[model samples]
Each structure stands twice: as C-alpha cells, then as structure tokens.
Target: MIEIKDLHKSYKIGKNSLHVLKGINFSVEEGELVAIMGSSGSGKSTLLNILGMLDEADLGTYHLDGVEIKNLTEKTAANYRNKFLGFIFQSFNLINYKSALDNVALPLYYQNINRKERMERAMSYLEKVGLADWAKHLPNELSGGQKQRVAIARALAGQPKVILADELTGALDSTTSYEIMNLIQEINDEGKTILVVTHEDDIAHMTKRIVNLKDGVIIDDRKVKQVKALENV
Candidate 1:
C-alpha cells in the first residue's frame, strides 16, 4: 500500500543543508505491520512524516495506495491524509477541553460525514478500543494509557487504511506499553497497515517485520518469529 523510491529529505540551516533522509527506499504492502527501529537522529520520524504526507520529501517518489503523493498540491495531500492516514504521536495530541467522544469525532468533521453518523462511528471505535465508558471524560480525567486508548480510538474512527504511529508507547510505563502494543497488534490483525517507529527492541519485536535505520537510511530489514504467543483477548 506504500511504495517509496530513492526518498531524500533535507532542510537548510543557514549556510549548510541537513539531510535527514539520504535516498532511502522501501515499500509496505497492504495489511502489513512493520516496525522501524532507530536511535536518536536516525530520521525515523522524518520518514514517517513523509509517508503520512505531513511533510514533503526533496527527492524521490512516494506512492500510497497506488497514488503518487510527492507532486500532490497541499490541499490535495491534506485531503488524502484525512481520508486514509491516521497518526498517533508520542503525545496523545488530544484537545484537553473536549470530551473523549468529541475528540474522536473531530477527524470525521472534515470528511463530510453527518454529525449523527460520525458520533456513532466514533463511539463504535471507542468501544472497540475499550474506551466506551470513558467517552464523556476529558483528557485530564484519564491516565496515560486511557488517554492513549482515546487517541487510538480517534485514529481508528476514520477507518484509515494506514496508521503512522510515532513512538506510540514512549510515554507509558512498561506494563501500559505492553498493553498498548497488544492493542495495536490487534488492530493490525484486523487488516490495517501499521508502521510504528520505536527505539525499544522489545516494542519493535512485536511486529512481524523490523526495519532498522541509521543516519537516515535503512541498515537492516528482517522478518521475526513471534517470541511469545499474543494474548487472544
């Protein structure tokens, strides 16, 4: 569902240019779950941003769901992103003033979906993520995991084809991280394409394939056998 060829991203810092991605190339098939591992300054987040159409690449082509996005206009790209891409950041990125249901309903507002139907869809996703009971709660009333669950619900509410998760478990404890990873795995099992950026090996290992990045390029790409049985819940 994602095809990237000779991708390069750079920014000018005064006199010098900082190249964050140096001609990186890779592809992700539909329904595939891939983990990207990298240390600080390795450009994993930059790659994710480019893939999600949140940022542009200086060179190379990016085809998402068979459509070339590198040349799309800003409005077109934003429309495509809202339709097919869902992003989960290290921070939950929820609106503190809104209720959980309202937060999840925000994305639907841009899609022309009717208000009643949007709320129904958002509440259904919240129920899927085990956050139905917390729909009326605000961000301040939740814990890290609960907030993350609400964020996940928000992402899934739009029925996105690709989920770009940047350090999704970075803000939670180990136990919460494990739970969150399992939840993501379940989502992937339901046929959503997932690309997760994480520095933790334990978190990376949860995915079926791993891509290791260094200095803005992929150093290793390998498939992994599940080390432990995933919970059936």
Candidate 2:
C-alpha cells in the first residue's frame, strides 16, 4: 500500500546540509504489520514523517494506494492524509479538555461528517478498542493503558487504510505496552496495514516483519513468525 524509491532528504543548518535519508527504498503491502527499528539519528522519524505527509522528500517517489504522493497541494495532501492514514503517537496526543468520545470524533468532524454519524462511528471504535465504558471520561481520568486504548480508538475511528504509529508503547509500562501491542495485533489481523517505528526489540518482534535502518538506509527487511503479545503480557 506504500512504496518509496531512491528517497533522499537533507536539512540545511547554517552552510552545511545534514543528509537524513539516502537512497532509501521501501514498500509495505496491504494487510502487513511492519516494524521499523533504528537508533537515534538513524532516519526512522524522518522516514515516517515523509510517509505521513508531514514532511516532503528532496528527491524520491512515493506512491500510496496507487497515487503519487509528491508535489501534492496542501489541500490535496491534507485530504489524502485524512483519507488514507491514521496516526498514533507515544504521547497519546489526546486533549485533556475533551472527553474520549469527542477526541475520537475529531477526525470525522474535519471530514464534514454530521454529528450523529460521528458519534456513532466514534462509539463503535471505542467499543472495538475496549474503551466503551470510558468514552465519557477525560484523559486524566484514564490509566496509561486505558489512555493508549483511547488513542488507538481515535486512530481507528476513521477506518484509514494504513496506520502509522510512532513509539506507541514508549511511554507505558511493559505490561501496558504489551496490552497495546496486543490490540494492534488484533487490528492488523483484521487486515488494516500498520507500520510501527520502535527501537524496542520485543515490540519489533511482535510484528510480522522487521525493517532495520542504519545511517539512513534500510540494512535489513525480513518476515518472522509473529510473537504473541498476550503471552508476554
């Protein structure tokens, strides 16, 4: 569902340019759960940002669901991002003032979906993520694992084709992390493609494939027998 070829990106600081990604070629097929592993400055975030349409590559070709992703107008980019991608962040990114139901409904609000449908879809996703009982609660009222579950529900509310998660389990306790991964695994099993950026080996192993990045290049990409997060939890 995602393809990038010869991707290169550089940032200018003063007179010298720092190259972040060099000749990176990557692809993710539909229904695949992939983990990208890399240390600091290994270009993991850069690659993810480019894929998420939050940033642009200096030189590369990116195809998402059969559409070229480069040179998109801001409006078009926003539309494509909303239509095809959902995101989960390490911070949970939930608004403290908004109730869980409203947080999940925010994305649909931008799509001009009416209030009734938005609430229905958001409630359905909340139920799917096991957060139905907590839908009316605020972020602070939830536990860390519950918060992450709410975040996951928010990401799924749109039913996007691909979900891009950055350090999704980084902030939680080990058991909580595993719980979140288990939820992610269930989602992937239902055929939604997912790409996770994580440095944690255990987290990477939970996915069906791992793509290792070093010094701005993909050093290895291979499929592995999936590890069940529920067992580890």
Q: Give the per-residue lDDT of model 1 (tens digit) for 65-164.
A: 8888867788998899998899898899999999999999999999999999999999998999899999999999999999999889989988888999
lDDT score for candidate 1 against the true structure: 0.90
- Which candidate tops lDDT? 2
Worst 10 residues of 1 by lDDT: 224-233
Q: On a 0 to 100 scale, what is the lDDT of residue 191 in model 1? A: 91
Question: Against the true structure, whose TM-score is highest?
Answer: 2
lDDT of 2 by residue, 115-170 (tens): 99999999999999889998999999999889889888988888898999999999
The models' CA-based lDDT, in order, is 0.90, 0.95
What CA RMSD would candidate 2 show? 0.7
Give all TM-scores, in the order shown.
0.96, 0.99
Show where candidate 1 strays beyond 4 Å.
227-233
